[model samples]
Each structure stands twice: as structure tokens, then as C-alpha cells.
Target: MAKKKYDYSPNDFVVYPAHGVGKVVSIETQEIAGFELEMFVIAFEKDKMTLRVPTNKAEEVGMRSLASTDVVADCMKTLRGKAKVKKAMWSRRAQEYEQKINSGDLIAIAEVVRDLHRADDQREQSYSERQLYEAALERLTREFAAVGNGNELEAGTEITDTLQSRVSAA
Candidate 1:
């Protein structure tokens, strides 16, 4: 945590590796092993969950600030491209896609959304496919809303429309 002490604070939005965005609710101190240990308690409203990251181990566990605007810009560009339905099996590809969505990096998550998105005229997505798509979309929207100074619902709609209209196989 000291390595990048300036990177985070209580109430700051942070990306928990593979968990998308969460709000730092508080930095808590507790007695452990007869010594005081500090921890960061972050809450994810979307998942209705809370995570406690040790202040000493936060950086080691991949907890950090949200992606910069330039990084999100690059991700938006990635979203505005074609879906390259890979030749790999669905199970293999689904796992890969899931991993990307969970990665705290916006660009990687955008790639997952871009790859999974299907236009209106395209073939329909499977049950799991739809599930993954919704997850990626939800995750991306929350982070984008936080950075863009907008509400989550608005961000979610924009992301949905943005990805759908941004690309086409034709």
C-alpha cells in the first residue's frame, strides 16, 4: 500500500482484480497476532457484497485505482469493432471471456464485451453466452459511470447501445 499510497483512499472508486469496480467504504484497524493490522473495506453495490483488503497486501493482491480516461477511450474503440467468433470451443472461450470481464482493467473487459456482443441480425446467443454478455455489460457500465460522472443506469444503456451499433459483420 505504501508503494502507491497516493493511488487510493476511503470512498475512492477502485478496481478489484476480476471483480470490476467497488467503493472504498473505510480503512479499518484490528488487532491480529497481538499487533494492529489495517485493512480496506470496499463495497460492491452491484454484487451486494463487501471485500476487506489488507492495507499491507492491497497492492500485492492487484487492488488499485480505476482506469484512466485514455484507457477507457481505447476500450471504447475496441468495442467499436468486429466480433471475431473464435474457432475455439465455447467452454474454452467462455472461460477466457469471463476472466477478461473480471479483470480490473477496462480495456481487457471491453475486449470481452466486443467479442461476445451480437448485432440484431446476427445469430442468437446461447444461455451462457447471454449470461456472460450481461455480466460484461454490467461490469463495464458500473466503472464507466463512476469515471464519467454519470449514473449507473444511464451508463448501462449507453454501453448496450454503443456496443450494438458500433460494429457489424457486413
Candidate 2:
């Protein structure tokens, strides 16, 4: 038997670039086209989606373990920083934000949330802006929760608290 390229085991939390976070439900080997293909069966409970990614292609597809404590701390620091909203067109900026959210990079996702965040006193976000902000927030929250071994709501509250504090301090 060939050794697995990745060390992901069942029930491990992993981030798939385009899909945020998912749990490795199982490692499966399925016969396909006269070859045995080993794959990771990942489940995104929140999205109600299950995805099978080839084990050998996990790295190629940007699948990785959850962020470390230091990375999470850096992400929080990113949230505390100023929002760097570009003066580009809405469509262009929206596309960029979407790409960042889907990149599965914790810091990039934090930047999207920070850039699109609207405080209570600030002008309201447009429909599209709200959508992108919510998506980024959700992705960040889920990973944060997984990293802390906490619930999503708690993680989300902590994240928002950090953002709100930054706003109040500025």
C-alpha cells in the first residue's frame, strides 16, 4: 500500500480554499477507470455539502489544516487595523473581495471583513456589499470557531467585538 501524501485523518477540520472549512468525515479509496483513487470525504455541515477530494491533490487544491493560534491572533490584529477599501469600481472591488474570501487565507478573509464592515453610525452597506461582508464574516467565524474549539456564535461575537472596539477606539 502506498503512503498517503497528506496526514489528514477522519474528523479532522480542514480548509478548502473555495469552500471555507470542512470536516474530514472519512478517507476513502474508490476504484475509478481501472485505478484506485484515494480521496478525502469532507463534509461542510453549515453549507449542507459533502465534497470528495483526491488525497494526492489536497495540496494542489489548497486544502490545509486549520490556522494555528498565532495565525488566528494575527487575523485578529488584522481586524483591528484600518479598513483599506479601494476606490475602484464596485464590481471590481466586489470581485476582489469575493476572491479573497474564497482564498481560504485567514488574514485575507479578515481584510475582507474589515474592509466591508459598517459600524452602526456609518452609512449602511449596499445589497452586494452586505452579501460579500456576510460571506466573509461567516467563513472567518467558522474557521475561528474550529480553531478555538468553540461554537460559531461565540466566535462570531468575539470577532464582531474586536471590529466594534476598533471602530470605537478610532
> Which is the leading candidate under lDDT?
2
Candidate 1 structure quality by residue, lDDT tens digits, 1-170: 54445357888999898687899998888888998877899998878999988888888888878778887788788888777678999999999888777666678788888888887777999999999988888878888888888598887777777786775334
In order of appearance, the predictions have TM-scores of 0.89, 0.96
lDDT score at residue 19, model 1, on the 0-100 scale:
80
In candidate 1, position 52 carries an lDDT of 85
Model 1, position 87, has a per-residue lDDT of 97
Candidate 2 lDDT over 6-118, as tens digits, reads 67999999999999989999999999999999999999998999999999899998999999999999999999999998899999999999999888899999999999999
- Clash pairs, candidate 2, are none
Q: Measure candidate 2: CA RMSD.
A: 1.2
